[model samples]
Target: MLSRVAPWLASRNENGLGVRVLGGADTLALRALANEDAVANVFILAHLESTGTAAPTSGGASVFGVFDGDTLLGACWAGANLVPVQLEPGLAGYVANAAHQTGRRYASIFGPAETVLALYSRFEQLGHLAHEVRADQPLLSISGGPAIGANPDLSFGSMADFDRILPACAAMFEEEVGYSPFLGGQEFYSKRVAGLIRQGHSLVHIDAQGTVIFKAELGAVTRDVTQVQGVWMNPELRGRGQSAGYMAAVVNLSRTFAPVTSLYVNDYNTKARATYERVGFEQVGTFATVLF
Candidate 1:
């Protein structure tokens, strides 16, 4: 089990942590809090920067939190993504109830493992199944650049290669997410993949026949860090000593966008973790994902 929840931000006065919706004026404090652990907070910070408000009233979602006087102890984003960051058990329970009360739909709940588990337990008790729960996934981050030789085969994918790469992308999504991105509809997810391709975020390694051998993407980006996700290798290519070096190539490629590259892997996945370690990723934290 993770350590007991800390009192860093949740209790600073006789009043204790006060829970409420964060407003636009809280933006500066939010950024400062996010900067404490840039890699872990990148998604929230990026969303905040994009929307200019902690709680965007225009359509996405809102940020609710537990604050100690004026210091933010932890916060939860109840938006399209449904993320919680650095939340302790008490704060997490509060946020979980808040999410239920608001009745907003979200895709996933992922962040620090303990907080995620805490929040998910509350949500589950409230009748949400959280169909798939990935607990104890190691969150890894690499600063600077790749420490090993890059795979000569890798390249940034492009719009022109969309049709060629779409199948590979779909395969990776299903394999990792346990469901096809096209489950609800193809157009939205297709456009999302295409948008990443247009931004030169998709990295691919192809064979002589032009079939994708391995592929991944810079899935999320912030000023100081970018997260690499959707990593997949051809089944035929597995256990061939090729993955680590290929991941090195991906990390080096990702450096063009941000100095740090981050990703999380299942704790049970020894092979993938080994590949990432061999390629220079260090476990900085742990993440959990409650997939509904």
Candidate 2:
């Protein structure tokens, strides 16, 4: 593994560049930037927060960076059992070599559309398949306007509600998000959900009937920017003009935490795009998700 990375590592040195695990005082600054940049990026940054907390099982996760003297040029981090974040412009060759050196099969990645295409091409040449593409875009706006409709009873979900809501949560994730960790069993799923909630990074909306309709996994509360993620609405309640209301309420509530807030929508999800637009979110940039 070291042998495979040697030449590339040497090349970086020749350019007065070095790559290693992130460290020191700037860790907080880097983490803040990643949170502002993107929520997924923030989640990756969370891994760097090993302050008395158990390091998340790398499972298939790792972070690397490219630096020139005191300047950080780029960095990448893959989540446990998920695709890695590819933040650099042209380091696909080095990435692939490193992956092979580590004896991994393939790496999942997501970022700007063009970057994904480039990495996909590079990975394909190395016999890896970048078979699935999830087209999504970061939607952002300064939140302070009146909501479009009546506010539903909304609150953060409690841990005790997990048993009743877990199945629905799993189904919504599998259907809309196209992934389900619970397929392994309730244990893995429970722990993952608990970890997210314990981080105080998720929001839930329940109707008067006490049903979970809309939920979003949010990132850390930092700066004036709050990030919305893993948004889900009950499938049976789609097209009732409710999504707009839910989004508006979430945004309105988020303002108490941060001045700026953002979320991502699948490019192919016109309905969601329209709903979000109705609530005042503007398209920032496109992101590509490569499923391995």
Clashing pairs in 2: 78-84, 83-108
| Candidate 2 residue-wise lDDT, 31-141, digit = tens | 545555554453454455444221224364555555678765555553432333545545544555455556665436666654555556666666777557664555455
> Could you say which candidate leads in lDDT?
1
Cα error, candidate 1, residue 96 (Å): 0.5
- Report the lDDT of model 1 for residue 74: 82
lDDT of each: 0.82, 0.60
Per-candidate TM-scores read 0.90, 0.78
Which 10 consecutive positions of candidate 1 have the poorest summed lDDT?
1-10
Q: Specify the highest-TM-score model's number.
A: 1
lDDT of 1 by residue, 163-276 (tens): 878889999888888889898789988998898898788999877888889999888887689898889999888989999888999988888888899999999999999999
Q: How does model 1 fare in lDDT? A: 0.82
> What TM-score does candidate 1 get on C-alpha atoms?
0.90
